[model samples]
Target: MDDTDQIVLSVDGLQVLIDVLTADGYRVIGPTVREKAIVYDDVASVADLPRGWTDEQDGGRYRLVRRDDSALFGFAVGASSWKQFLHRPVVKLWRARRSKNSWQVVPEVPPVERLAFIGVRACELEAIKLQDQVLLEGEHPDSHYQARRDNVFVVAVNCAVAGGTCFCVSMSTGPKAESGYDLALTEISDGEEGTVFVAEAGSGRGRSLLAKLPHRPASAADRQSAKAVSERTAASMGREMRSDDLHELLHRNLDHPHWDAVAQRCLTCGNCTMVCPTCFCTTVEDASDLTGKEASRTRRWDSCFTIDFSYLHGGSVRTSGGARYRQWLTHKLATWFDQFGTSGCVGCGRCITWCPVGIDITAEVEAIRDSEAD
Candidate 1:
């Protein structure tokens, strides 16, 4: 990653740069205000972005309210997640046909498109990394995942505003990105100074794009201002969690009463897993055609919160909703490091922000810790 103080575009110049990228054969997907929420969609022009739009959210609560400024990427994530693009909520796996003597099966591998994801938050980037480890690093990498991930370009944005539920600072995934992006942007603005984007190239591909743009070398003051902004955003987080000794904390607290306490409020709707950037568990299903002459297989995202997620020969290993919820929370906050060498959470706070029952993971952890301290 190269943070060489490059001033690639003024805030207004970003629109022109997007057009150039589109002409250069990149499918640009970015945030646009729709139905009162910032959503990722195909953007042909700068006007497509949610200018003068923003959002307000709390646990089990969301509203598409207005902001004082017309900042496009001023809000955090919404109900939609990056998983919708990568894993796909629903897809056909293969079509099968039966002959007189035998059944013939043809496996399907869906084609992927070249995409340039713009304004990706740091937590979403971390979730992509986690999926890469699960989908690409295994003995058999998914061909579809490989195609999409390998071909896509990333343009990460440092958060200028933290959502009411955001806690990326606690997860150490933001407000300034450290890795996993092709290009990074920090928006700079003031009533008198106007707006500019402090740009940096994170890869060779990013440098090539930077070279084509009309830009100047950034000053030391520019870098300092960017840092200051990121720092402020990080400090303003609505929640915090103690991650040190998390594994031990969860491991020792398996029988803690906090699990049952959380279960009372947890609806187990799996919204947390669905909104999570890194939860990659999925299930495959096979179904026969009406005529029984053909069959199809499908794969869709699944969550441990579901009762069937832990089904065994006899029955579900985790019989209680409380147990299932505890398993997921523990795996993400505690045991994920042992298995993957990284915490499962990137602190996007989607789990907490979107949960129908307003179950907060940070609060849950703190409760467990407080009990242990007592």
Candidate 2:
């Protein structure tokens, strides 16, 4: 059989797989209930997963609820994406200390952790690839990001339930994982068999790990069930965007009245950027000791919504909320194609769900198209 062939793993065997990964010195990180929400955290067993629980998300709303059965990956994504581990919110770049006659410099090197990420969604996988293009394929590739990314393993989850704000189906980035995973799983629950994972190996490492697990060759029925899960999610999506000529549409509507309308409700809190899986903007900060003997440079996540983000020689370029909002939206939906050859958004819908004022990006795009039609 081909190495990429599908297999079926019982729910109990899933724990054994986790045990094997942890035994191999991989820090397994997956979804867990935290602060009344399902967020990624350290996992050693099935108990760490959001079992028998799911989430309800909408524009500016999120709540955890009990599921009918114990399905490990029944819920859609939460505010936290895997980018937190790979890109990091804050990192020290280097340090310098004053010497007797000259300055002594010490470069800060980030420690690489052997990480195995569980429950990675399809859209998030695409986001990871986008970040690789941004941080690993650029003129000045980020050694720090590359080190962590290289040491990481991905266990992707195909969605069975689409969040109220999710639009990954529209973006062609989710509801099903196509590639970029060591192993991909589609959770299936049956009255007789209870819950089982239909798994597929995407890499040589995945096949090697599966060989060690208690998994059997998947049957035709299991494959059909897995396909049904993705179909249900695609049909149940609460939001969607029309992507036809989307880049050109946004490029032409730079001064659209809709931007001003949304800007009035926007708080510019940077929550959207914080939750977005693909937003990669960052700022560098330098700090010195009170004695001015020691100093360090640090890189921290930044957002375009901030006034200082667009600061130039004279002052902040995007001083108005409308201008900043325009810059962010245009860059994400339009100019990002020019810069990266793909849209900055993966349609995970974190931006819409976490927006303070329930601002839906798909709705905004539709409004622009409607106005142009009129």
lDDT of 2 by residue, 39-73 (tens): 89999889888888888999999989998887878
- TM-score per candidate, in order? 0.95, 0.98
RMSD of each: 1.7, 1.3
Encode model 1's per-residue lDDT on 182-212: one tens digit a residue.
Answer: 8888877643446677889888888788777
Residue 155 lDDT, candidate 2, scale 0-100: 94
| lDDT, each prediction | 0.81, 0.90
Instruction: Give lDDT: candidate 2, residue 83.
Output: 91
Query: Candidate 2, overall lDDT?
Result: 0.90
Off by over 4 Å in 2: 1-4
Candidate 1: Cα lDDT at 354: 85
